[model samples]
Target: MLGRLNHVAIAVPDLEAASVIYRDTLGANLTQPQALPEHGVTVVFIDVGYTKIELLEPLGADSPIAAFLAKNPSGGMHHVCYEVPDIHAARDRLKKQGARILGDGEPKIGAHGKPVIFLHPKDFGGTLIELEQE
Candidate 1:
């Protein structure tokens, strides 16, 4: 089951600009940019007390973020992550409930260095859901 709202991700055409908006303009604290090659994104996390804000930029030409940017040129909310006590158990339960899991149905290391899985957007009312192990 979901534990807490982990972080909300926003795909951006320019990570620097986005970070500036959150950090300089909004006066939010941000982490240094982290390149997640496996996920095909470079991310910056903004500390917002109760929850974090993740800014994602395409890492390469084939990056999924790149594809998303292609479709939504200005970029947008990409996904929302929730913490789960056990990702495997959560995956199985969701599967049994007819929720579609994405990417081979296996957990991968996420931004927090925790096991994570993505659920299909269509299965969740057009909003992509990410489950991160707590």
Candidate 2:
């Protein structure tokens, strides 16, 4: 039920520094930083062809990115997002197959203003998976 690779998310300790590398160094097109308080992150999207790279920085001490940074110290790939034609259907199918969905198992509005849900990393080869409705 997954469609295409949507975007790869990277949790960075320093958002501005990361933006510089992607923008100035790599010559990537990046969006302005946007604070997503609901998700507890400040994000910027680096456009690369059809797909994009999402840079995430912790918005507060309780942010999940903060915990991720605490373990990695520097920062690392946080998750990979895939598009889905119908998010609810995808969730039900995954659930039936015994895949664990993170959080409350409900779709939340994502950065692209689309419904999204995160699946448990352990179920997807130690890589967090995000499903976004297209």
Candidate 3:
């Protein structure tokens, strides 16, 4: 089962520009940009007290974020991540409940170095849901 809200991810065409908006303009605390080649994204985390905001930019042409940007030139919220006590158990439960898990239905190391999985957007009211093990 899902736990607390982990972070909300926003796809951005330019990571540095977005970071400037959050860090300089908004005066938010932000983490250094980290390239996640495995996930095909360059990301930065903005500290927002209780939760965090993730800014993602495509790392490669094949990156999923690139496709997302192609559709909506102006980037937007990509997904909402929720924490889970046990990712494996959560995956099984969601599977039994007919929730479609994205990718190969396996957990991958997320930006926080925690196991995470993405669920189909259609199953969650058109919002991509990411479940991360706490």
Candidate 4:
């Protein structure tokens, strides 16, 4: 089942710019920034109660977020992440219930460094879905 609202993912052109805005304007405390080389992205986190706010900026042309930005231009909210008690179980249930996963495989380390997977928007009322488990 669901655990908590993990974080809201925002796709931006630059992680540092996003971090500055979130920190200076919104007063969000940012976590140490890191680049996920395997994923081709640089990400930063901002605390939001139990949930966090995640900013994603592609580090390479082939990154999924890069493609996402191509479609969104100025960029916008990318996905909503939900915390699950069990990732494998949640992923399995979502698939059995007809959710189309973005890729065929197991959940992997995502923006927040948590095991995560993306469910196609078609099955989630048009909102891209992200599942994460600690």
- lDDT digits (tens) for residues 38-117 of candidate 3: 99999999999777899999997689788889998889999999999999999999999999999999999988899999
TM-score of each: 0.96, 0.96, 0.96, 0.89
- The 10-residue segment of model 2 with minimum total lDDT is 60-69
Between the candidate structures 3 and 4, which one is better when assessed by lDDT? 3
Residue-by-residue lDDT tens digits, candidate 1, 70-127: 8999889999999999999999999999999998999999988999999999999999
lDDT of 2 by residue, 1-134 (tens): 76899899999999999999988999989999999998999999988867789999999768978878999878899999999999999999999999999999999999889999999999989999999999
Which ranges in model 2 have alpha carbons more than 4 Å from their true place?
none
**Which residue pairs in candidate 1 collide?**
none
**Model 4, residue 10: displacement in angstroms?**
0.4
* True-vs-predicted CA distance for residue 12, candidate 2, Å: 0.5
TM-score of 3: 0.96
The per-residue C-alpha lDDT of model 4 at residue 15 equals 78
Q: Compute the lDDT of residue 18 as modeled in candidate 2.
A: 92
